[model samples]
Target: MKTNVAQLIELPKFLDKRGNLSFIEEFKHLPFKIERAYWVYDVPGGEVRGGHAYKDNQEFIVALSGSFDVLLDDGIEKKVFSLNRSYYGLYIPKGIWREISNFSTNSLALILASTSYNQEDYIYDYNYFRNYMHEKD
Candidate 1:
């Protein structure tokens, strides 16, 4: 299996006196076509979300309302991405672990996935992910 690195992608932002607008079109602004769309909100303070890795799903996460931090681990290395802008998003490929935390009040996180929900495609154990990555190489 091939490994993909996480990256920050900038979206097109249009400035106007009325309000600022940003958008992401399927396969135009993202690496993969969107098969599913989801949003996370109403997170209490000091709470965290996401604690798993996808087997073949890639995602692009955007902070549409407030700020949050994304912790990504690719078995051997880990990185943190701070998302506080609507025009910037973090793109995470498959075979990586992710966690979201430190959300501000009324924060809205929009996620676009390349695949639909599949129970068997999730790896929630860090040790299992490490072993799986090792075995793949």
Candidate 2:
């Protein structure tokens, strides 16, 4: 299993006196084309959102408001990203275990996915993930 993780996308910020606008358009600014969009909200502080890995979906996560931390584990190393800016996004590739937590009040986590929702694509079990990842090779 390959556990290579890196930042792949960044939203462009257009600074203006009127208002600061940041945009992320699929296939134009994002690497993988977007097929779905979702946002996490109404989450109590210290609650976790995700604890799964995708088989073939790529996602770009942005903190539209407030702040939160994303814990990424590629089976080898772990990385944490504190997302607090709406103008910036963290690009997460496939096959990485992710956990989103520590949300501040009124925080919004916007995610742009490369694929539409598919229950079969989610590996929710940690041991299943390890086995499936090993079999992929």
Candidate 3:
């Protein structure tokens, strides 16, 4: 598995006088099928979230309301992605550590996941995640 598989994806958008609309279809815009969806909202400024890595699940994160930054680490390198547009999203592949921070006021984060909630698939410790990556190599 490649370490730097994370990337930004743009969704289809239609502009109108009433308002703007964007839509994402599973397996069309994303590489994986969408099985679950959730959102994060009302996060305080400068707060951080998602200090873990998924073993099998993939995720796509979008800023539905405001702006925020996603820190991605592949155990050897790190990168930061800013999501401010509703039509754009960050696609996170499996086995990469992710942290969301630097949230703007009233930012809404919508996350589309490839799987349902599974506690056993998550690796929350940084040291353990590095070890897992090393084993994969």
Residue-wise C-alpha lDDT for candidate 1, range 71-110, written one tens digit per residue: 9998888999999999998999999899999999999999
Q: What are the Cα lDDT values of the candidates? A: 0.92, 0.86, 0.92
Off by over 4 Å in 1: 1-3
Model 2 earns a TM-score of 0.91
Which digits, one per residue and each the tens of the lDDT, describe model 2 over residues 1-137? 11245473567888999989988887676677889999999997678999999999988899999999999987767899999999878888899899999999999999999999999999999888878778876
TM-score of each: 0.96, 0.91, 0.95
| Superposed Cα deviation of residue 106, candidate 2 (Å) | 0.4
Q: Per-residue alpha-carbon lDDT of model 3 for 9-96, expressed as tens digits? A: 8889999999999999887878888999999998887789999999999999999988999999999999999999999989999999
Q: Where's the lowest-lDDT run of ten residues in candidate 3?
A: 1-10
Query: In model 2, which residue pairs have backbone atoms overlapping below 3 Å?
Result: none
Candidate number of the best lDDT: 1
Better of 2 and 3 by TM-score: 3
**If ranked by TM-score, best first, what sequence of candidates would result?**
1, 3, 2
Which window of 10 residues has the lowest lDDT sum in candidate 2? Answer: 1-10
